[model samples]
Each structure stands twice: as structure tokens, then as C-alpha cells.
Target: MTSSPLSPTETLASARRTLRTEISALQALDDRLDASFHSAVQKILSCQGKVVVTGIGKSGHIGRKIAATLASTGTPAFFMHGVEAIHGDLGMLTAQDVVMAISYSGAAQELMTVLSVCKRMAIPIIAITGHPGSELAANADIHLNVHVDHEACPLNLAPTASTTATMALGDAIAVACLEARGFQAEDFALSHPGGALGRRLLTHVRDVMRSGEALPVVRESTPIPQALQEMSRKGMGMTIVINETRAPVGIFTDGDLRRLISREGDIRQLTVADGMSHNPKHVSANALAVEAATLMDTNHLTQVVVVDDHGLLIGALHMHDLMAAKVI
Candidate 1:
């Protein structure tokens, strides 16, 4: 049977109550944190093998997220279903590995079976449960209590606030380990290479800069009209002016041409050097593409030349290249 929906006022009140309850649970968990939390972090840090996080039901779902957070933040971890662990997945564990088992009641039978195997193998177990007195907590090398006074569920039977507390505690653990290991953003980007942060941190100017025939190049002596043709052919809106040694000396842009024409009223007498902006900004090919983007933004430039350490021009980077690589 469909129950009557809550009135708007009642619905807002209900949402507020849920949020307040979860916030209270998190506050309580924070207040209750003690030395055991430190021990858990140290154990995981000292572990030579991966952290195998296992649980059942809602705790299992939370465990999977916790495992992923830990993995992405520099810890090597993976989630193993409690039932699967008993039926052959336990082989994934090693003597050097650590087990992080979660259960609100701390009495999951599957977890108990896995705990037995961990005991025999002398592997350390870190337990997260709402009950510190339960067998899993009592037997674990370290116990983290996520106890809440009551769940946000109207019936107080659903996982609600307890699950929120569990997930928050898991995040706390991951962040602690991350800080302890001195994990940096570059390290995180390595793990998440397909993510936006990865693209920004890992992509270099050489990886995205136009090179070879795609690079718009012109000699300082090249006529302004011919330089404009090179810019159009490359579609970069600008052409790099190079000396005989192919070192970028200046850059001529569409804006520069328009300004020069407005001032000179030329009858096609000017060379690129006559109108080009001197000392064009350049970055080493090994510099990060994001760094090049920063340089462009700071200087109000549309393009920057890519060069070797010796300042020999290798390629050119237009803002469009950064956009195409999603590095901007």
C-alpha cells in the first residue's frame, strides 16, 4: 500500500532531522576517537601488503568505498566480500597484509570465518563496529567504534546514521594514512591518470604542443602577408618568428597585424619582424602543460613557443592545444 506523502513542511523537517542526526553521529565518533585509531593507522602504514577490506550488507558497501578511497590516496587496498573471503577469496590475503573488517553489530558469521583464517596466518585485523564488546572488536588487533545513539531511520532499524558514521570514519582513516605517508597531489594523479587532475599534472607541453608541419613558423625576414598565410594554414592565429638557427625571436599575431595596419597603412612593405612582438614567451618542452596555461593566462597570451633547455624552438603551443588536450 502506498502511504500518503509528507507535506512540504514535514518533508523539510524530516530532511533536517536526518542531516542533524548524521552530523551528531559524526561528532560523537570524533569525540570517541582515541589511541586505537592511531594504532590502526600505524598498522596499515607498516603493512607491506595490501589492505583487504571485507564486510557484509551495508557495511560491505561502505567498505568498498573506503577501499577505493584508500587506494586512490596512496594506500594499496581492495574490497573483498565477506562471504567470498570464506569461499576462496581469503587466499588473496597474505601474512604481510592487513585486514580491515566492518560490521555494525560486530557479529557477522562470514567475518568470523575470515577472522579465524587471519588469526591462523598471524595477520593483523582492524575492526570497525558500533559495539566494542562484540567478538569481532574483542578479537581484533584494533577496534574503532562508530557507535551512534540511534539511527536516523524512523524505526531505528536501518543503517542510516550508523552508515554515515562508518563512511566518515573510513575517510578519516584514509586521510590520516595519506598524510602519514606524505602523499602528494602528483602521487594521487598517478593513481587517477584518467581524471582531470591527472591530465593537468601529467600532461607536458611537448605532449600537446604543435610540432613538425603543424607548427606555424616564419622567418623574421618573412613578409607580413606570408606570415599571415602561415598562421591561417596552421589555424593557430599566430606564427613564430625564428632566426636562421630556428630559435624563436618574436611572435606575430592577427592582433599585431591589425594594429600594424591601423598605424602603418602599409603597401605590403613590412616584414614579420617589423610588426612582430619581441621576445615571445617560451617554455621548455618538459614543462607541464598546465604551467604553460598559467604562463599564457598571466601574460594575456594566446600562444607560447616550446623550446629545449638551450632555447632552440621545438614546437609552439596555442591555447587551443591545451583545450583540445583538456589540460586547461
Candidate 2:
């Protein structure tokens, strides 16, 4: 039978109540953590093979997320369906592997079947359940309790607060393992190469800087008009003035050209060196593009030169290049 719709105030109140209940469940789980959690982390760290996370129903959904989080954060892990294990997918298990089985009630028959197979294969099991005394938890090598005092559901029948606690516990374990492994942002970026963090960490100056023929370069003795022409052709808003060894000695930008024009209206005889900003800012080709962006922003520069270890100009970077690469 359809129930009457809740008024706006009642709907908001119900949402707040649900959030409060889940928050309380997470708090209880946090307070209850003890040595077992440590043991679970040590087991995972010591495992020679991947972590196989398995579960059924709603727990399975949470298991998939936990497995993904673990995998992305330096702990090798993948999700397995508990039901499929007994139906011949148990071959995925190895003696070196650790199985993380999620069952809120700690009594799923499929998980029990997998548990027995794990025992026979000498595979370690880490069980996450709401009932610490339940059969699965009792038989497992390690047990993590996700017990909740109440469900967020009005009837207390659906997996609401219990699931939230279980997910939070899974995150806690993943984060603990991540810290133990010394997982850093660079490591995370490797696993998530298409993400924003990956772009920021993995993209180097050499990858984004315009090099070779694209670089707008002129000799220090080149006329100001010639330098401006090169800058316009390259569309970098600036030109690098190089010495005899092709080392950047100064930079001539459109802003400098405008200021020069404003200061000296008759600049037809002036060379690039006369108007260029000496000791131009430069970065190493191996530096991260994000670092270059920081340098540019800090100096209020529209362009910066890329140089090799010996201070020879290898390339140039414009603010627009960083914007195009999405590094800024």
C-alpha cells in the first residue's frame, strides 16, 4: 500500500535523522576499533598475492568499492562475487592471497562455502561483519566488527546505518594500509592517469613546453622589430633572447614592447637586449608543469623559458600552453 507523502519539513527531518543515525554508527565503529584492525592490516601487508574482496547483495556493492579503493591506494585488490566462488570461481584464490569477505550478518551461505574452500587452500580470510560472534567471523583468521545499534530505515529492516558503518570500516582499513605502504600522490596518480591529480603530477615541462621550431628565439643583438615578429609568429606573447651559446640572457614580451614604445617612441634603432628583461625566469625541462605554473603565477609572468642543466634554452612555455594543458 502507498503511504502518504511526507511534508517538506518532515522530509527534511527524516533526512537529518538518517544522516545522524549513520554518523553515530560510524562513531561507534571508530571507538570499537582495536588490535583486530591492526592484525587485518598486517595480514594484508604481508600477503604475497592480491586481496580478493567478496560479498553478496548490498554488501557486495560495498565490497566492490572497498576493493577499488584498496587497489587505487597501492594495495593490490579486486572484487569477487561470493555466489560465484562456490559455483567454480574459487579457482581465483591462491594460498598466497588474502580474502576479505563482507557479510553484514556474518552468515551468508555463499561466504561460508568460500570460507571452507579458503580453509582447505590455506588462504587467509579477513571477515567484516556486524556480528562478531557469528560463525563466519569465528572461523576467519581476522574479523572486523561493523556492528550498528540501529538502522536509518524507519522499520530498521533495510541495510542503512549498518552499511554506512561497514563502508567506513572498509575505508579506514584501506587508508591505514595506504599509509603503511607510504603511498603518495605520485603513486596514486600512476593508478589514476586520466584524473586531475595525474595531470598535475605526471605532466612535465618537456611534455607541455614548446620546443624546437615552435620556440620563438632571437639573438640578444636582434632588432626589437625582429623579436616582435618572432613572438607574433610563434604566438607565445614573448621571445627568448639568447646569447652566443643559445643560453637565455633575457626575455622580450609584448608588454615590454608596449612600455618601450611608451617610453621611447623612436625605438627603430633599438636591439632586443636594450628593451628585454635581463636574467629571465627559467625552469628545467624535467620540472612538473604544475611547478612551472606556480612560478609563472608567482612572478606575474605571461611566459617562461625552459632550459637544460647547462642553462641552454631548450624550449619555452606560455601561460596559454598551461591553460591548454589544464595544468594551471
Candidate 3:
């Protein structure tokens, strides 16, 4: 006889139970944070060289991610495979470096070997394992216990809850180290320069906006036809409607021009004030490009005026500028 497929209700209940078990495991992990965690963060923060993270199998995968997180969050770190470290990769270790070893059982031969080498080199060790009394934990300079009561796996043998707890603990360590170093958003953006998030965080409107002659600015008293001429000359698809003092009070876009021509049937009768949208959304030149994008999106506009704190139009940016800057 073949095993029957689980019913929808049974499958749903099983998934919910697994999730609940993992949640409880994470809560236990959270409750266990204490001086030991603080010491680990301090140790990582004091490291003169890069953080060397190593582990075997599933733990290795988590170690890789932890190393990446630490590296991106202000701590310099890299993952060295435990087994490979015993080979030629041992050269990656230095006396100034700190080793973070991960093993659920804490007795993996490869990890233990690397730990032994680190000990001989006088490198500091931070151990993450379920077994607090195992050789790896006992020998480590700082031991972080990642014990979980149950696995999310039905068989209770696979690393489910344990890995989740380990990852969360790793994130906590990274964040703590980040705070200790006073790492700022600009530093994070530097690390992620190739990603869209980096562009959004690092770029300001002033960096991408069109200023001076490239920006179309016209007085409210200017005729609609002249404003249209200014829009064409600047080729920004919009012109800033400014007051006598050169402060932006409105904007006239291609859309606004089309609507006016369609509704009035004669463009000669309209002035810049009549065709322009009053009190248009504006952004500061120093604001993050993402914030400018948000303002444009919130106002249903393809372009927005960039102003200084005094409400003087300093520059202008089109949605295309954000796309070109990779801040979209």
C-alpha cells in the first residue's frame, strides 16, 4: 500500500505547527541574550583584522550569510570553509583576525581542526553551537549557545529551527557591532554601491537635478505660448512658474498644456498662471533621490521642482533622471 497524500486541512495544520515551533525557539533564543552576547559583540568590534567565519554543511551556508551581513554592516568579515581552512585556506587566518566557528554538534572534525589552528595562532574564537560543553565551545574565547528545543522538520533531525535561531543570532551580532562602531547609512550605501538601495540612499536630488540654464523657470506673467517655448527650450517636459522674487509657486507640465488646449481651444488667451498647477509638490535638493521619487509618485507627477529651504527653486529632476541614476 502507498502512503496517501495529506488533505489540505492536515497540510495547513502541519505547516502552522512547524511555524509555531520555530517561533517558540526564536523566543527562547531571545530570552537567552545576556553578557555572553555582549562580549561577542565587543570582541568582534575590537578585531583588528577581518572576521573569519567557518563551519560545515548547513552551518557553512549560515556562516556564509553571517559573514556577508557582518561585512556589509561595518564589520570586515569573510567566510572560510572549515574543511578548506585545514588545506591551503589556512593562510587566510592571521593572529589579528577573529574566528567565528559554527557547528550544531560542535564536534565536526574539520571545524575542530580549524579551531585548533586558530588557538595556536592566538586568534580569538567565537563559537556558535547547540552543545555548550562540546570541545569547540569549551575552547572558544566566547561561546554563544544557539540551542533550540525542536526542529521545524517533521522528522526532527534536519536543521530547521536551529538554523533560523543561528541566523537571527548572527544578525543580532552584526547589528550590535554596527551600533558599537556608529556605522551610518552612508557607510552601508558604500558597501552596496552596485545595488538600487545603495543608489537611493547615497544619491541626493542635487547630484542628479538639472540646474541653471537647463532648468526652465518663467514668471507667472509670462504668456502660455512663451512658457511652452521655455519648456521646449529646456526639454524637461515642464516649466517652473515662479513669482516676481524668483520663488517657485507652481508648475506647468506637458499634461497641463494639453489639458488647457483641449478645454479652452485657444492657447493665446492663457498665461503661465492660468495653465500651471498651483502648489505643486516640491523636494529639497539635499533629500535622497528615493524621497524625491516618492514625492513625484505621491503627486502623480513625472517631474518635480527642487528647492532650497527658502523655497527658492534651485534645480529640477524628471523621473527619467532617477531611472538613469539607478535610484528608481
Candidate 4:
């Protein structure tokens, strides 16, 4: 029987099958992690200089990410082009540095050019490739085998699964090394200071919450109109209603004003406490913005009153402020 030309449905099915096969291949590869993997971790952990990652083509792209991940995770590393190394960039290599060469076939000519230079410098070469017995692997101090049995691409010729496996292996290496060195979240956040998670972990409420005279505050006995004036003057969505002790008792918002007017209530006759939402959500000055965000979300609030340990109104934080600060 002859094979028939695939219909559209069959073509899609074939593509899905390839991806499934490649995904399974990675799972199979995961089981192979053992003492050798641990040994590689030890080598990187003890390195005195930066781990220089290099490759050509698709492998080069993966190498760049590996270098960045390693660098950001406490391992000093950077990427150098294999071709550039021979064209005077070889001086970037030091005896103290470790060379990481990446290739799918372990036969990229540009990588081979730099591998010999690494050898001359007495630098330890770590290779990540699909071919363990290939020259690039055999020439290295340690070869991280990233072999994939199939490609996620329908043609079975693209770098899809191979790159995925390489990336996973790079992450595995970085994590193992990080754990061995007892790396902490604070350490990781320091390198990712521009991201939301970093801001949440580092930014204190005191750093961004409105304070000083700008804080929205009004006495409980103050008339609803006066409290509305305070809220408007402060530009905060709500004003903190407080007693003589200067401790917060309630809060009044634009939302509350709408509801009070809808009831045909007299704003001038009402007290600040009458229009306030008692038991309004509050945060401490030292609280993390991320915690504040969670509290605001859970309480269905757009703003939170910031108070000191004594429950005295200190400042206020709005949802927009959190968004601008990238805390959201």
C-alpha cells in the first residue's frame, strides 16, 4: 500500500504528534540527570571567573539566554560570539574564565574555532549539545547532553525541541548552582529590580504612599461637606475620618458621596462619620506594596489608608499609584 498525500486535518494531526513526541523526549531526558549533572554544578560553583557562553545560529540564541539567566542568578556570565572570538575577541577569554559552547550537532565550525582557543588558554570548556560523542563534546571538560529524539517542527528539521531541551538544561544548571550556593529571593530580586516582583519585594509602603500634609484626613465631627473638601484638596479617592486621638475611625469616598446624594440626604447636616465606610482596609507604612495590592483586591477597594502602629492615619495609597509604581 502506498502512503496517501495528507489532508489538512492529517497535516495538523501530524504537527501535533511531533510536538507531543518532542515533549515526551524532554521528559525522558530529565531522567538522565545524575552524578554527572551534579559534578557540572560543582565545577561552575567553584569557578573563579565568569562563565562565557557561545554558540552559532539557533544555539547562539539559546546560549544568550543561558548566559543572562546564569548572570542574573548570581553566576557571573556573558555571551561571546564564536566567530568573533577568532577575530580578536579571543582576548576576552582569561585563564580564570570558563567557556560554555552550545551546538545541536556539536559540529558548528565557528564553535570549533573558539573551543581550540579555550584549550590554549587552559580554560575549562563546558559543552551543551545533542551529540555526546561528537568532537565538541569530546573536547570539553564537561558535556551537558541535550539530545532530543524528535523536533516539535513538522519538518523534524527545526531547532524547537533541541532549543527547549538546552534551555531546560541551562535552567537546571543555574538552579542547581544557585541552591548549592544558598541563593535567596532577595539576591535574585536585586538583579531583577526593574520587574514587578522585584518592586513588591523591595518597595515599602513608606516609599510611595502619600504622606505629610497631602494625606487625606478629617475629624469625625467634621461636616460631610468639609470632609469632601479635604478629599478633593488631597486628591486622594477617600479621606480618613479620625477622632480626637487622631486614630482612624472611618473613611469617606467619592462612591459614598454618590450614594448619600442618591438617598437625598443633606451633606451639610451629616457628620464625616455618617458618610464614611467604617472598618476601611488599612496598611502599615512598612508593609510591602504587593501585600497592599492583595488586601485591596480581597477587600474590593481602590485605595487603602496607611496607618502607623498606633492606628493613626499616616498616608494613603491608591490603585493608580500602585500601577504607576509597577506593584500591580
Best by lDDT: 1
Clashing pairs in 3: none
Task: Evaluate model 1: give its lDDT.
Answer: 0.95
Give one digit per residue, the lDDT tens place, for model 2 in 166-284.
88888999999999999999999999988899999999999999998999999988998778789889998888888989989999988889999999998989999889899999999
| lDDT of every predicted structure (CA atoms) | 0.95, 0.93, 0.92, 0.87
Model 1 lDDT per residue over 61-100, tens place:
9999999999999999999999998889998999999999
Q: Per-residue alpha-carbon lDDT of model 4 for 212-244, expressed as tens digits?
A: 898888887898877878888999878888788
Question: Looking at model 4, which ten-residue stretch has the lowest summed lDDT?
Answer: 264-273
What's the TM-score of every candidate structure? 0.97, 0.97, 0.77, 0.79
Per-residue lDDT tens digits of candidate 3, residues 63-110?
999999999999999999988988889999889999999998999999
- The ten-residue window of minimal lDDT in model 3 covers 193-202
Error of 1 at 135 (Å): 1.3
Candidate 3 residue 274 Cα shift, in angstroms, is: 9.8
- Model 1 — which ten-residue stretch has the worst lDDT? 266-275
Clashing pairs in 4: none
lDDT of model 2, residue 242: 89
Give the residue spans of candidate 1 off by over 4 A. Answer: none
Residue pairs with colliding backbones in model 1 are: none
Runs of candidate 2 exceeding 4 Å displacement: none
